[model samples]
Target: MKLKFDSFLLALLIAIGLAYFFPQAVLFQDGKFIEAVTTVGVSLIFFFYGLKLSITDIKYGLKNWKLHVVVQLTTFMLFPLLVLPFKSFVANAVQENFWLSFFFLAALPSTVSSSVVMVSIAKGNVPAAIFNASVSGLIGVIVTPLWMSLFLDFHTENVFGDVYWGLIREIIIPVILGLLLQRYLGGWASKYSIRLAQFDKTVILLIVYSSFADSFSSGVFRTISTSYLVYVFIGVSVLFALIYGILYVLTKYVLKFSVVDQITAIFCGSKKSLTHGSVFGKFLFLNNPSAGLYFLPLMIYHAFQIFLVTIIARRYHRRKEEESQ
Candidate 1:
């Protein structure tokens, strides 16, 4: 029952601690500097993602239409629906913010690396996992915003229009450009995938640090008590378990998937992407005082999912080995 702690999760905790104690460190409190750095970093992250993407794997993955549909619906639709009922109970702005954080966590995409890696470890359908994970991010770029627009009204004039435009400029355009050059550079991207992943985590850490720094400096967390964070942690835990459990039943019994496909379905369907959470939050919550509050649930969920899934994947791996004998 021992679970290994991910170093990046540790780094995330350290990033938050640093932001708390030294909000102004590296001039992050100034806003514009960190904004500029993270903006470029976000684009580069997506670009590298595009460069490393495999069109063949996606095509191969599409053959499993039933599994793909189930996983996609779980990720984009069911997760949000599970949380939507609570919105009616949001009695005040503070409650709404917490609710919105939960909604955002529900709306996010699946993790690409972790989902595929875990599926592989569990002797699951790896190609489908890769395809589902990759497509989930692209889908989230559009879907996440539309979901948020239903609940959030921006201060800017022409808010939705501006948000879409920023998404195109910062995320979509870079991905497109990277895909275009992927034919020439894709190999290089794959060769350096591990390094690029490190680069991605670095950007995410910077974003986390900058976000919390702003929140800390502006006294945003003062509005939030330690007890509220416990509630959020419990909230995300329930959301993760609920979705994971639902996918398990649907894939195992209803869909009658092979154990491999079931593994892919549950793992890819239940996870959310912190990388996307960080990048999309920058645009969605731009200059909002509560930006850090919005990200808190996602960070907690990201860490929790990794811990829980690693255990599940390892057990599946062990069972497969035993059966092979």
Candidate 2:
């Protein structure tokens, strides 16, 4: 079988190339116009997200308390802990920025669309996948920043003020508004989920372009060598492999979950969201020159996870089909 390349991955590469070649066009300007655009895009993305979420779905998912606990712990707690040990190693080897980027990737929530899709393909617990994927992003809005603040002094003056404000304005409020209007707009949102997904990817590409443009212009990438980037790729791959293997064993053996729930746990727990990474990075790393480098691990991990998981998901799907037949 021929290997297929994802269009979004291709688009991400093109965005980076454009940012490198034409930094002026994509770089954020002094007036904050581009920043405002990204903020609006983020709000709309969350709004649409809320519109699609069903309260009943969440309630159904919560019935599996053990499964939810495992998934959440794997996403927020275990993932970060796995990276914490490498802090001094990464800092000494590359720079503080590389460690920060890796930590940021670890702190992010799971991918909503892809995780659910993979679970469904693998004949996993679809409702639980949807619920976990959706709730993980919301949880990350609060949890991710808290994790970052533990290491980086986000607000030297106001402490929690700025971070909370950003989350409220950009993520929480919009999601709440969407939920309030879900009765009226939920159907419409569901009908146009594909379009909204495209919109989300477009906004992410814009953010990527602006970030890399700034990094390129500021010579941030210059500090790192090509060899270092290869190491980062290896590191991300190893991280994914380790997490995936552990989750597989825990869900399959220790937890004694069904095959379906095992698939959901492994996929949802192992993946991270590029969507949240892009938008949250904009707010968290504002005015910081290392912003582009901050997204590097996420981008690489996003591509790698999708590619590797697709093959695994397809194999599971095929096995299920054979068994049923």
Candidate 3:
């Protein structure tokens, strides 16, 4: 039987509580250790991600190019443009540079598994969704930092130096290696994907835990207030709704895609990439434990997008079934 993904989300919440409640945990005792664990754990997650994708999947994915472009462009480009105008408004009202970095997070790639899985579950174009998610990821590694440099000004300070390529190598290079060795690895990959899906959720929880742990360590939680939390939630909820609404109008009317493709586009387009946001965020805020600052606003958006898209995907799936009947 397939496990309920909600269980994983709940487990992640529990893990976050573990890290938050135990601020002085051993992982956070040494900065270097926490960094090392985060690095290793994230790489392992990507390695398994690579192994999970196969040659057949890639070929299958290539068939739906329109679905790929529309969804990915919306994800890695259009969403950021929508969020950019909010930057000046937020800048006028808010003073936190880290919160502003959330604008850049909106421009990054889609998540690997969730984007693909959500579309698949909704009976959309799974192959194209998977391909778009993976390609957008590869593009994000390069394009994201470049956009950051152009917009966030990380390049001017030379913060884009050293060991960052290791992140690329771990995720992209391994996938290429897996593709090259698919004949041998593909069999093992299918067997482990489920277990690794659990690991994927755990890895994300670890990331959230470790990151929030740093904020806790630095007493950053004190800086955040209940009113601020309420605003963040409300703002993210609005943004999620707006993105989905815009994409739905475009896909449903302007493009006239099949209902499945429409859901695929909106779901994939409307979501932000937490994996890249958290990982690349470290580079953007290097040497600062408060780096979680960049992550904070984007984190609310991630949760909001998933919740909103789940409802939309289910509705689309039901409509699809009724039409088929």
TM-score of each: 0.96, 0.96, 0.87
Report the Cα lDDT for candidate 1.
0.90
User: Model 1 Cα RMSD, Å?
Assistant: 1.6
Question: Root-mean-square deviation of each candidate, in angstroms?
Answer: 1.6, 1.6, 3.1
Tens digit of per-residue lDDT, candidate 2, span 3-76: 47789999999999999999888544672777788889988998998898888978889889888899999999
* Residue pairs with backbone atoms closer than 3 Å in model 1 (clashes): none
| Candidate 2 TM-score over all chains jointly | 0.96
Q: Tens digit of lDDT per residue, candidate 1, span 86-145?
A: 999999878998999999989888899999999998999999999999999989989999
List pairs with backbone clashes in candidate 3. Answer: none
Which pairs in model 2 have colliding backbones? none
Alpha-carbon shift of residue 193 in model 2 (angstroms): 1.5
> How many angstroms is residue 243 displaced in model 3 relative to the true structure, after the best TM-score fit?
1.3
Order of models, best lDDT first: 1, 2, 3
For model 1, the superposed segments whose C-alpha errors exceed 4 Å read 25-30
Ten contiguous residues minimizing lDDT sum, candidate 2: 86-95
lDDT head-to-head 2 vs 3, winner: 2
Displacement of the residue 230 alpha carbon in candidate 1, Å: 1.2
